[model samples]
Target: MVRTACRPRWSAVVGKPFSAFPREVNEMIEQFFGPSAANGSTWFAPLSLWEEEGNFFVDVDLPGVAADAVEITVEKSQLKVAAERKAPEGERQYQHQERTFGRVERTLVLPESADPDSIEAELKDGVLHVKFGKRAEAQPKKIAVKST
Candidate 1:
């Protein structure tokens, strides 16, 4: 009886199946970079909401987004905020670029007693702040009577 040699099914350094790996990965893996349309990426900016002195305040961080690129509106007791930014002018080569540059729209639901006419918004140093007065709310009242 004769025994034939069986080839070893080896994997890459990362320990993945050789056949399962794509052929492009085995190649030099193009080290160049190019730009892509970032017109719809997940937003990473932080936002905060607070209420004080019969008013509601909203603050959002938009570091790279310009004031002109942002739009704010209120409809049906909800605030909508959107921002869009374009890529830089110069050539940028990125091995792993992770900057979002898309139209971002966020909906902020407000209480039914929110005053929309008095809403105000401002952007400074990449920080957006919005404030709106609250509508008058009727609360429980108690009355006391003396002996007649």
Candidate 2:
């Protein structure tokens, strides 16, 4: 009989396997960040979306980004948010650098119910809040039933 040492698989040590992530997750990552090497200087601003009272809302985290450096646009059924975070001016030796400085952009597809004309956006406390009101037809309508 031969004896051999056992070793744990990479997936076992990393929890979920790389393939365990859903396709949509991979697609979303690609859509938001693009290929890793495509733009090494570029970083992404995390964001969240939700719906309430027949309206949609999106909030994006933009830590050091300036309001003037941000741009929001809507075309057709798509909404695009872009911003730039500039690094500190003047030359300095940095002990450590973790924060990212570059252009970051995200494009979202608005639902058919979304009203582009009703969209509103505001930036405060390093967060960008975007709200999209629902179309008149898309708003919930209470139906009445009549008895003969």
Candidate 3:
């Protein structure tokens, strides 16, 4: 079993399945969760990725985070989303508190034909919606010609 130690800057990690994940993901997850996060206990069911009808959608459940606390970015064909969840103030001790918090990020390599120019992102009712379109070149096109 491979082991990793991540701490400091634990604010830049994104957790996803290793089989479907990349090295950057491990780095980001470690950066956010710190050295004690690699045991799989720090994250449960990391973010999910999906698609339908030629459109790609990523739905992240961030119950305790506010819209303004999240950061979403698209760079070099990769989309990165990060956020921080803070417990309510006033030194409240908890016997057990298990809610994804502190910082979480998800990175995806958009299809080569993704249209970064026409992307949209919004957080509503505790869920984040990041939308983008596939380039016409990527979508199947039809052509016709008259025959004599």
Candidate 4:
């Protein structure tokens, strides 16, 4: 008679399959981040930030949001953006909802070289664009050295 060694699966030893663990985690994430009820719960939006030519640019996605409802402020080394997105009028029932609504706020820590006074922002095409100019003193300066 020939016998072969067999390895025990982790799920089999734990009673529940390991594959179900990921699904449970996903459900928890969705429950926390996904939209809830009809007019309750807060959600986060996507933001893009980058730097170019001694200037920092921040792009915030704010679709379905009114321009008048948005506000941007620069305080110390922190940049704050606040906006509100109202849901459509006469809402009945939703089978599946993913889009976020209501008050939304995002804050970013500015670089040490960022000039708060030179900050500018404009919202166009449902996207909020903010630019921060670096301080002149923070820019690199050329120095001349004498040959020995």
Top model number, lDDT: 2
lDDT of 4 by residue, 1-148 (tens): 1222353222332565565564355445555655432223365657998989889999998888888999998887999889999988895687666555689888899889898899888889989999988899998888999999
lDDT per residue (tens digit) for residues 1-148 in model 2: 1222353322222665665344445444556666343434356677898899889999999988899999999998999899999989999787666566788888889888999999889999999999989999999899999999
lDDT of 4 at 31: 55
Ranked candidates (lDDT, high to low): 2, 4, 1, 3
Error of 3 at 60 (Å): 1.6
After the best TM-score superposition of candidate 1, give how far the Cα of residue 100 lies from its true spot, in angstroms: 1.9
Q: The CA-based lDDT of model 2 is what?
A: 0.79
lDDT of 4: 0.76
TM-score list, all predictions? 0.62, 0.73, 0.65, 0.68
Q: Please tell me which predicted candidate would have the highest TM-score against the true structure.
A: 2
RMSD of each: 15.0, 9.1, 8.5, 12.1
Model 1 Cα shift for residue 105 (angstroms): 1.1
